[model samples]
Target: MTEESSDFKFNYFFGLVNLVAVFLIVWFLWYIFMNPNTVMKLYTPMYGFSLIVVFLSGIILMAKVLKWPAWYNRLFQKDKPITKGILLTIIAFLLMIGLNYIVFWGFIGKFGIAYFSPDSIVASGGIGAEPFVARENASTAIVYFFTAFLWMALFWDLGFGRWPWQNDTYGVQAWSKLFAILFFVVLFYILLFHSHVCYLFYPAQDKAAVTPWWEELAGTGSAFFSLGLILCTLVWIVFSDLLWEGKPWNRYEVDGESTFGKGFVVFFSTLTFGIILIFILLMIFNYVWMEPFVGGQYTDGPDWRYIHAGEIAGFFILAAFIWKNYFNNFPNLDSLWLRALIRSIIAVVLGLLIYWFYYSPLATFFLAKVEGFAQPGDTPLVWALLFLSIILVQSEFFDGWPLKRKK
Candidate 1:
């Protein structure tokens, strides 16, 4: 809004670059529309490298400008570090919603114009459809949340003269917590719109504390993949922070400084990653037999293959969480082998729990009910695929005749 702010784009030169990119995209589209062969050919790592720099720079800039909580919240209330962010986000969401309403509902309502119909938004370049309104809103909201979350963490670490949260030093841990919160804020927008595909679920039988609620919640395959985005970001952030600090690992030992768990989590999860093959097999049968087997009011997963997939995926997820919590992030324990043992055990336990809880019910639901009373498969191939997957994950051994071996 200010002259300097506009010129600086808060702190990013990429605002100019983004504008240029937009112009280029439009031109490219126009060119393609006019002539099939007209196209911009950009082939170099540098092109990608430049975009990365632009992206990071824009994040920094937007943080400076849009950081209402970081600036205004700090001034008004000294307590509750996240208050500023939460309040600012609520206001922003309401405003975006209101604007959409005004454009579609208010002005259009009064004028009765075709331009204001939900269809009009689609025709004029808004997100399409009744269902996709949520998807589009969520998608746009993701961009907004990422800008806010990543920027807040970026600035706070810079402001506090501390490393980013990923560094895990005691001083910067506060920022890490804030960073995690911000990441979840991104999830909020993601789930608000597309709660269906998240693959979250609850137990149909109910009241079993051991039951995985996340599976129930993931019913429609709307698996809060947004959370996966944030988690992946954190994984990279941690890696980058280590790289920046001349440390190869995110965590350091107590007696001295050493990095132990570099590829452990990745390898550990991968050991059990073979579940996918089984899931695909069951999915085929789920479509074939589930409706005939289990004829009940199931939501989007009428076939039950997806439901079973949700169950099995839950295992890897549980193992990942456990490996993260108890071992990769162990307390009072700091040896590679020890961490490995703890993680592997936790992972197996989590894995078994997933098998017992989700896969079992889903299998029964799909295989037994066959549209009238039962559902999913009778093929040895599907079971064989899954059996092989378990071995693949357990061995944590994946290499290829033409490929590199997994660590």
Candidate 2:
């Protein structure tokens, strides 16, 4: 094969391997920790440990194996890919593990802010009945933060051409991306703390049962944190495929070429479309299945299970689309539109299959194997979201960090 074709094959091989490995890791961890009997045996250490592995593996894959940017060369002053990959993986493992402990346990859990609210944890079906591992507690917060950061880095910074700012001088693009990240952080802060928009979906409860901290914040604590989780997952669904590989909508004339008007139109339009699609799917599922079972007493309040199911379907649909668009490991056809149509059909089929398997077999297995684990709850989705987040971080940030390809 030619050099370009060889590189493509190598990338495809590694990508498939990585996807399988991620799936196995997520499954194993869920099986182990979600099991109430054996959960206490390895809950804390294994949780953070697995994250370290995932994060380090992704960073190493992007920095060393892909070698997309030249800066990773400085990590170990190495010429060999395997050498670089191993060395960087070790370094990242250590750094992430240390940071995970400090941030998740030492600071956030001890202080009880952001996603560590005590009451919120219990409300969402507590994990281990322990303060640290409970829902919306330190461990979950750590995972959610990692996912949210990836969403910000990928969708806003890299995918939308906010990073490597188009208008900046040659040396200033890196700084521009940093500023963009800071801008996103500020925006997240505003959404979580300052605005009532997120509450529209999450819906604040009465302060009677809330903790003092939550009450002080006008009962928005749970909604605030839950909004972060939901937004990250939603953004992943909307942008992960299109940003990295697919071209369902022609958002730009060329790769990495987007003006403010173009970027705004593309970003909002795609997001709105994804949201509407998900809403419709949720409504259908609710009407067809949920309403009949519950005697037509379906409340209009937010049903998190349906929301999580819709997000999972969105993720799978995008996955199928990307598999066809970027990695057409199938027979190639002459017509592009025909190929896209086939891919769209594949997406719908895959989405339905995923919905069926997750709610049926996966749910039954988890409920049978793990006591106190809510299969219909957000825990499983959170784990899946974290996995996708690592992929985004690897693809969008480390793969192209500190450098933008010049067309």
Candidate 3:
């Protein structure tokens, strides 16, 4: 084989090995910190997972969206990839911890809203006094907000591609984009999830927030509808970028640059595609499991079904990322559409494999999860997102170290 071919095989082999290594590392951490059977179970899967996702989202904003690390890269210009990655990871974790605990739970919860503080929620009486219930509820609201934050971040990156700030200095650009993203995150949270979250507690805080408007259509007031849609939206967003290479979306760019029109097009199209995906996945779920009925819980429930669809989408997101990073996004066909189609198929197949493995008997034993689908208090997202976080950290923070070729 040629030198180029030999190197490709070597890189591919190591990349796959690294993928397994990263996952084992993450799994070890998860079992220790977030495992259900563990004494320090921290919180319910949802609560712990939400906090993790929020931290991961913050890292994505700093590392990828705002590209803040690029600015810092100059300062650490002489550092190796591993050193830079370690330092950046440490700083980012500390920053997120402060923001999550000190700012939100500490200051905001103390001086502003009661819901931000689990203690305050617990102290308020009623359902809040219930064990673990208050923290779950608090996390539910927090995750909803950050979920919107993540969607906006991905959307902005995919659609806008740094427009308006593309020419600005790193400091100006990063902070400006940060503010812009936060503005939308808060706006979307209020319009979409705040009402549902307010109603999550007993004697719903109707005065604090409005009733969910999508309750009738979505079969419940739960924000999982929003979460489902957002997660599905994310699948398409990442798929477009990685699998399709931004085919149709990039085609809409004006003068070879991202414009308002292009961004808006990507925004609506992906969401529309997301809705379709939810429909299709739900239909598929019906054949595999019992039909969802009203007032049903878990597997036969509508609310969980919505979020479950998103959970499946999360797998696709992870698979796409893995494919792009590890396997060189294989099947380098000549036809663009054909290549995209094959890549899509590969991603979906791989996603389904992950879905199976996650819920498998072996996985159930290790994860401390009860055997069966849609068990109460069990979500694959925690695992999926955890895995995705590690992948992102490897690629973005570590610059694919050990696998990345140097200039």
Cα error, residue 364 of model 2, in Å, equals: 5.2
| Predicted model with the maximum lDDT | 3
Give the C-alpha lDDT of model 3: 0.82
Greater TM-score among 2 and 3 belongs to 3
Tens digits of per-residue lDDT, candidate 1, 125-152, equal 5324343453333233333344334433
Model 1 C-alpha lDDT versus the unseen true structure = 0.34
Off by over 4 Å in 2: 1-6, 10-70, 73-81, 88-99, 104-147, 157-159, 162-172, 192-256, 291-301, 310-335, 362-378, 386-407
Per-residue C-alpha lDDT of model 2 across residues 1-407, encoded as one tens digit per residue: 22222333334555556566656665665566454445543334325434643464345333323332445555444335445444554655565655565554456545654343334444555333445445323344454454444445545432455333566653465555555654774555444432332222233322312332332332223333333334434443443343223354345535647455555655665556655655565567568455322122223223343434445554564455335323432324555456555655565566566556555656556433322212322244444444454444434343311121213
Candidate 2 weakest ten by summed lDDT:
398-407
Q: Count the backbone clashes (under 3 Å) in each candidate.
A: 46, 0, 0
Q: Model 1 off-target regions past 4 Å?
A: 1-79, 82-311, 322-332, 351-407
**Model 1 poorest 10 in a row by lDDT:** 395-404
TM-score of each: 0.27, 0.61, 0.94
Q: What does the lDDT read for residue 376 in candidate 2?
A: 27
* Top candidate, metric TM-score: 3
Model 2 pairs in collision: none
